[model samples]
Target: MPHTISGFSKLSKSEKIEWLLNTYFTDKDSARALVKQYWNTDDKLQKLHDEFIENTITNYYLPLGVAPNFLINKTIYTIPMAIEESSVVAAASKAAKFWLDRGGFKAEVLSTEKIGQVHFIYKGGFDKLEAFFKNVKPKLISDTASITKNMERRGGGILDIQLRNKSEDLPNYYQLHATFETLDAMGANFINTCLEQFATTFKNEALLFKDFTGDESNISIVMSILSNYVPQCLVRAEVSCKIEDLKSKDIPNPEEFAEKFKQAVSIAEVEPYRAVTHNKGIMNGIDAVVLATGNDFRAVEAGVHAYAAKDGTYSSLTHCSITDGIFKFWIVIPLALGTVGGLTSLHPLVKFSMEMLQKPTAKDLMKIVSVAGLAQNFGAVKSLTTTGIQEGHMKMHLMNILNQFEAADTEKVTLIEHFKTNIVTHSSVVEAITKIRESGNFK
Candidate 1:
């Protein structure tokens, strides 16, 4: 059994690793060696990685790849994606190349509004709380002037503040709902600061309100924070071409492919089970780019999932249609991304990713990220409607499976050629490799 030690954080890096190994592993030498194997060789870089989070032991790596030929808003871009999944980058690239000749993708920002709230309880009459809120609203705004001054100068600051009463739903629950334009920053910290200030002023003023009687006078603030549900902060991306132009090598018949693709999206829109997996495919691309850029994928995932279920039922984020001679596929998702703040300037790879993107603004990043989701969905739907998803996905996954079997470079080359015609399954690959070894074919 492991015992908890006080002041564990005060230990030196080596000391901490020693304690962890002693506590957990029987073979401490080998375990310690395994941990240090991932550390950066450069002393300065390793230190930088260690300081990125608390109680850091060593680095965890994911492949950073680029998907080229993404034409958005008539501008060509090569998107950088950091992910461990086998087929995500390949799928996204295929989709981008497919649409590249078909007029590529078009994207536009619908809105840039974000939200925050302050929750408090007041066991008083609703009318009395409403009356007090109206009188205190201006003061709440004024008290946050210091916090909003810099943001205002940047042309992005508090947009509006409104009081909401939810006494019927939860006894004496009230919220100070606020909206903001964060410009080039994700603005969580900014919105949270303003909310905390608003909560302070609200509680301070409620104590002095003349209308308050009994429990109404004692307003207890529960918490103040920025919401991850920014429905209004939306971006739309789409690809459209003549129905005849949708024909490809795999999709020999444009009309059949288009019809099948439309039906697939429609099913996802109404079926919760399909919709959940469908949206996850879209996020495989979105989250990869979001992570590469050093933005918060968790917040993006939360906001987008909420937006999908906004109609009281979970549904697909991407939609498709074939009208007249045109076939179109598109998605509109809420993405609050930043190009200037947080890790964008600090992390080396993040800075490189911004440069690779031509240093887009928040709105531009929104368009790019939305296009990524749309392109990813296109690839998935196209696969689902045609040769099915596994053929391509498993082909990309073949290398990973090969590596797991401990195949040598020579064996990998032989298997790659052999599997070109044969179906690539784990069992089949393993059996073939074992037979080849027993035959002494390569040796």
Candidate 2:
């Protein structure tokens, strides 16, 4: 019974919601009520949220949890994470506390370079195209002076541009590959603007170039955009301590634990299947911080995963080693983040998250974010090598299962105490709940 609607975007927010309810829902009143319940109580704040995106709708909420005791570079921090998944915040906190006494994490930024490209089809000889590009490269830089002026003042702007011929892969395909130094901002708009200008200037100059033939003069601009695969914008974070100092409740056998942890990382390095999940654990921390701070998690994910496979095979982003009596765990990742632009200045929670971190610049944010990923990976690998992943994960997931079964307050209290000494699983919890209900054990 689906049908198309006209001028959907032009409709008012209420009108759009009405159309959606009428078109899709069997229980329209319930659906409408549920949507309205999530809206902000303050009308002005609600209006702000609505204007953030098209087809203004109710806000989706996530728990904004903070993991404390992260001692990165001799300074303590409590990192904010906005994610729905259970156990992530707990794991990060546990890892941070564990490392707090073990010399803490050290982090540094390696680079801050971002990339963009002007992909086009030039039906011309390579030599002629090369000559035309060389002649137009300076113009490409100069023509974007208006756009680059402010960025240049902030110590970030266009770095270099080169002609890339892709004739072997496809006929008459080429690129104006460019690199940029976009200091603090993610600079998507800035990079894209520069690339479009480059494309325009290149194409316009090609038309006047005596080297290009009649067909070669027509440079077909396919697209101009920024690349999310920023391998050069990297940061490294590490934690190291003596092997004996690693002994704790979870890791009683420090030597064995160190070897096992290293072996787990090694397996992930060679096994694609294991590497994907291993890196996902790392992202649980990275993406949480990224989202909480109003940066692009998707871009970070794409870039990190690509960096993992940059060696021709997908491998672990983290590495572990034990030399002499010292145990070291580390991760180096590409994170093109910002703190002054985009959502950092707009969203209320984003501003709070930024302030909570003492208002870090892009490089400082990179170091902190990298430390988060490393801390998360360490916690995951430690759990995987010792008690296994499910025990802690299932314990954290117990409340969700309880809510799904709709257990009463008293039932929850009793069952929680009982499960403290017993195994936790869906069927077992359900069975226990059934027994309590059938026995009428309410005191």
Candidate 3:
């Protein structure tokens, strides 16, 4: 069994690796060689990567790709995507190209509001608590003046504060609900700092309130944190064209295709099972951009999924419709993103991605991300309703299958050509490669 050691993080890199190998591995030498093999040869870059997180080991990389020809808000852009999935970039690129000629995509930000809360318990009269809150509200705002000064200069700061009573739901539970406008920053730290200050001020003032007699004045703070749910931080992106223009060589009947697409979205809107997978396809695009830009994809994912189920049942994030000879597809999602803070300033690739995006503001980034999701959903729904998702997905996955079988360059070339007309499956590709090797074909 492995044993814990003190000062593990304080150890040098080599020492940490040595301790790890000795603690767990029988073949320490070979394991040590394998770990060192992934280290960057450039010392400075490797050092930078090592310092990015705690207990550093080595860098793990994902492919950073670009999908071109994305036209949003009348401007063309090439989006950077960092992902390991086989077909995500391809699917997004195809969708972008498809809509590029059909009026492109229109995107707009609906709002930019974020939230945080301070939960506490006070077994006090509700009316008295309300009066006390009103008395102290100005102090709560004034106490955080220093914290909000810079944000205020940038035209973004505390927006509102409210006292919410939830004693009926949970015994003596109350919350100080706060909202903020962080401008270009995600502002989790700012919101959290303000919340903690508010909590402190609330507790301090409660002890001095003359009306509170006993435990009513003894407020116990539960927690103070920023909420990942930002329903108002929403952006909308859509693509629309005349129904007649929806005709394609693969899908020749524009009217029928449009109807099928609408029905497909309708089913996802009502069915939880389909909605989960359906929204995941949208996130495959959204998350790629979010990760590439150094924003928190995990938070975006949580908030978006919650928004999808906001109506009591999980539903599709993307919607489609047809009216008066026009076919339309769109998605509106809540995304609390930043362009000026966190990894955006530290990560080299993140900085490059922001530059490539023409240094968009926070609102601009929201619109671009929304468009990515809409484009991705278009690609998925188009494939699902017509040729089936596997045809394109497996074709894109063929190279991975070939690499798994350890096919040589020449063999891979021939197989690529052969699979162009043939179906691609793990078993079929393996069997074909075996036959080619057995026949003494081009080595």
For candidate 1, the lDDT comes to: 0.92
How high is the CA lDDT of each candidate model?
0.92, 0.92, 0.93
RMSD of each: 1.5, 1.3, 1.5
For residues 1-443, write the lDDT of model 1, one tens digit per residue. Answer: 34889999999999999999988899998999989999999999898789888989888899999999999989999999999998999999999999999999999999999999999988878888889989999899899999999999999898999889887799878899999999999999999999999999999898899988887889999999999999999999999999999887988999988899999999999999999999999999999999999999999999999999999999999998888879989899999999988888888899999999999999999999999888888899889989889888888999999899899999989989888887878888888888888994523
- Badly placed stretches (over 4 Å) of model 1 are 441-443
Q: Which run of 10 residues does model 1 get worst, by summed lDDT?
A: 434-443
Deviation in angstroms for 124 in model 3? 1.0
Alpha carbon RMSD to native, model 3: 1.5
Question: Which stretches of model 2 miss by more than 4 angstroms?
Answer: 440-443
Q: Give lDDT: candidate 1, residue 235.
A: 96
lDDT for 442 in candidate 1 is 25
TM-score versus the correct structure, for each prediction: 0.97, 0.98, 0.97
Query: What does candidate 2's lDDT look like per residue over 1-443, in tens digits?
Result: 36698899999889999999998899999999999999999999899899888887699999999999999999999999999888899999999999999999999999998999999998778888888888888899999999999999989999999888888999888988899998889899999999999989988888999978779899999999999999989999999999999999988899999999999999999999999999999999999999999999999999999999999999999998899889999999999999888888999999999999989999989998999999989989999999999889888988999899999999889988888887888888888888889996523
Question: For this target, which candidate reaches the highest TM-score against the unseen true structure?
Answer: 2
